[model samples]
Target: MKKEIHPDNYRPVVFKDMSNEEIFISRSTVNAKETIEIDGVTYPLVKLEITSSSHPFYTGKQKLVDTAGRVDKFMSRYGNRNKNK
Candidate 1:
């Protein structure tokens, strides 16, 4: 409640390059580089590689587990099996 001693808490925070599904409630956690432009006003845009829209878990689509079949092959080689059984 002290004046002139409080930290600056009034700064514009915006996250850029977010997926279309996460833009409405998205806010930047810290200052980031963004290059956003709207109505002649431009700001920095954040670039994200993946979000709920692109993530495999959130979208309910399983990602390709390329190593899955390899595991079976390994087990067969290491594990001993009875020839008649």
Candidate 2:
């Protein structure tokens, strides 16, 4: 609850998630050079790598990688030393 400790230039900005191509509008003080039109209105466009719409924690969607192939490759290269011991 401190006075004059916050920014005064708060405005509506558009945050675009690059991963999922989702856009949302919120109030922020960030400076953006790009502008985007949404619903016949223009807002400062900000590009983001991850957002609530695309994040794994919020959307419960996880990308599964093929780790078994990597493990097998590593074991074939270095796991032979343990077999002789």
Candidate 3:
């Protein structure tokens, strides 16, 4: 708990998740160039690439990779060489 070390310019800021377009309002000392109006109030808008609402772990929306297709492709390209040796 240090005094005069923390910033004193805490203000309301809006964080917008770019991936899912989720907006959250919280107090922060970070600066932002863009402004947005929400619920008749204006707040500094900050754009983020990922947030809890859009994150794979939080939203439980994991991307499924086609591992079988990749295996098949690898086998097609090099499987014959192994069989000859």
Expressed as tens digits, the lDDT of each residue in 2-85 for candidate 2 is 999999999999999998899999999999999999989999999999988988899898985667698788778998998898
Q: Rank the candidates by TM-score, best first.
A: 3, 2, 1
RMSD, every candidate, angstroms: 5.3, 3.7, 4.3
What TM-score, to 2 decimals, does candidate 3 have?
0.72
Judged by TM-score relative to the true structure, which candidate is superior, 1 or 2? 2
Each model's TM-score? 0.43, 0.71, 0.72
Q: What TM-score quantifies how close candidate 2 is to the native fold?
A: 0.71
Model 1 accuracy (lDDT, Cα):
0.57
Residues 1-85 of candidate 3: C-alpha lDDT, one tens digit per residue: 8999999999999999998888999999999999999999999999999999988999899975677699679778987896887
What TM-score does candidate 1 get on C-alpha atoms? 0.43
Runs in model 2 with CA error above 4 Å?
65-85
- Per-residue lDDT tens digits of candidate 1, residues 14-38? 4532445343224444556656565
lDDT of 2: 0.92
**Number of clashes recorded per candidate:** 6, 0, 0
In model 1, the number of clashes is 6
Extract clashing residue pairs from model 2. Answer: none
